[model samples]
Target chain A: MGLIQRVIEAAGIATIGISIVREYAEQVQPPRTVFLKWPFGHPVGEPHNRAQQRAVVEESLRLLYEIDTPGTIVDLPFAWRRHDYSAWDQPAS
Target chain B: MGISRWKNQLLALLATRFPALAKKFTDSYTPRASTGDIPWVRPAVPLHRAKLALVTTAGIHHPEQQPFDMQDANGDPSYRAVDGDRLFDNFTITHDYYNHSDAGKDPNIIFPLDRLKELVAEGKLGSLAATHYSFMGHIDGQHIDTLIRKTAVEIAEKLRQDQVDIVLLTPG
Candidate 1:
């Protein structure tokens, strides 16, 4: 994604990334990146977690605004605690 | 268990069972971190309503592009392109590495184009470009980077030509 961002930026357009793996994405460092501590696949917080998801979207947008230089990453301190819910194991009704 | 903790336990077990594997994981582990700056000059005016596109690296191959090569299956670096149809139906991910607990969900489990389109309809995005893109992530580092860069360039060019504003990369 950072690589893509670089290419997009080099083409003279603003670019950013939403990295599932925050730490790894930071190393690649696109012009702008939103970091979610949530595990892979659930990048925008999680399903049914609309508030957190919106917050993530907002934070991601803010990254575009708050970035002073390229390759900026804003870490949103949201964690996915699937263990809190045992219903995950039950079959869907 | 937390994924991180599970990873630790898995690593420990691997070490206990296969010392060599443990050494390998320990040596190759790259901790994630936010570091470095990407050199970019924002558009003259930041894109207020940017169209978004998605790209995936899930080794999804269309029957036409190239059949999944079992010979190259084990350690093949090159990846095939999956036709953007119902190709994802009955999707079976084959990679010896990485945990497969998330497999068998929705093929979109890897590439969620429908979800993106949903957001587009809800006006979360200005527009969803007609075409979405994908690539197999398994490849030689040089080839992977080259192919990814080439694809990104093409996508960016086409999007720019089509007046696209943003691209959201979904790496599975």
Candidate 2:
């Protein structure tokens, strides 16, 4: 997270970040952030689940609304599925 | 700071110092390239609370372009080229491993444009960019360095053209 924040920061852009695990990001402090409870990969939602994806996007955007003060952080209301492997990792046959 | 923390730190030292094939191993953990500690090589557009864009690297294939070869994806798909200008109105999520793929490859996992539209309805954001971006997720940096940088430029240009204020990378 530090390296990415550095790269994005170096690009001269202010960034807002979201992460399932945000301890490292919190320590490093990107410009802004939103914390999510989902697993590492499905930050938005499950694969092929467009509706859930939209919800995630909406929540992430809301984070931008509060960025005016700078260094603002928000916690999202969404939760992650408990089951493992709702989809497959290997390419389909 | 704690006993467990110290133990974990010791383990990391031992692993790095006395791995079975220490010579064969390289310090693969690279930070994003930088001339120094300045961070990004180029500046991203200022993110205002306005219309935003989403980009994904889930190996999404447009109906018009060649489909992602599963066989190739399993191994040396690093040679594949990114077609940044291509428009993909229709796409499908391929593997479930997007949570673990590189940001450049499976961007959609992080930036879900389809979801952004819904948020607009819910008043979470102002709007979505007219067009989003996608690319192959499995390319090796060595093989696709030029393509990745070019695509970033192209994406930034597109976002600027679209008047997007923010880009949300979801990585799911």
Candidate 3:
């Protein structure tokens, strides 16, 4: 996403990326990014939550004019409603 | 138990106790590098009037478009052009790395096709670009040059042709 984000921005089009992984987002910083510490494969939110998805999109778009810094990454206020992390059977360390 | 869960727990514990050591340990194996220069573009117009488009790395493609090649272990770096005029009825995912079971049921989770159109209807966004794009995120670094040079150039042209003002990228 970072690579493509850069490409689009370079083409004179603005872009904002919603990232599931903060590590990668920080390294390949795009012009604007929404960092949702939510688990992988669900960047927008859980499967069919329309309200949450719309809120996420609104917040991301809001960053377009709110942020002036080139690589600003604002962490969104959201958490997984489910405690399950997919590897529930794995022994806890 | 798989090694990944254990590793993640150990990393989390180390991060709390020995922060420096934890970072070193994590950084040792996964040396981070920027994919390309981050280019900045100020919005020429207000977002409500700007043309918007969606992009994803979840390997989403139109039902008729050719699916991403997952046979190659190295992965495919190509992207697909998706129509942005309406909500997608169905999308095919060829990415094997991510757990897309739910995405199969509802692609808007990753692509946000429905949400995008909703925003347009609400007049939150000015308009939707004529086209959108998707790519498989599992490609190896060996094709980084091609992806950045060739594929990116191609996608940029499409965005330009559509006069897109803002691109929302959903990285699955």
**Tens-place lDDT digits, model 2, residues A1-93:** 333333333344444566554553444444566777555455565556544555555456555445554344577766554433323222222
Candidate 1: residue B154 Cα off by (Å)? 3.0
Ranking by lDDT: 3, 1, 2
Q: What is the TM-score of chain B alone in each candidate?
A: 0.55, 0.51, 0.77
Q: For candidate 2, what is the total of clashing residue pairs?
A: 23
Local distance difference test, each candidate: 0.51, 0.45, 0.74
Clashes of each: 8, 23, 0
- In model 3, residue pairs whose N, Cα or C atoms come closer than 3 Å (at least 3 residues apart or on different chains), thus clashing, are none
- Candidate 3 chain B weakest lDDT stretch, 10 residues: B23-32
lDDT of 3 by residue, B104-129 (tens): 77777798877777777877789888
Task: Please give the distance, in angstroms, between residue B90's alpha carbon in candidate 1 and its true position after superposition.
Answer: 7.0
In terms of DockQ, which candidate is strongest?
3
What tier of docking accuracy does candidate 1 attain? acceptable
Candidate number with greatest lDDT: 3
**Comparing to the true complex, what docking class would candidate 3 get?**
acceptable
> Which is better, 1 or 3, measured by lDDT?
3
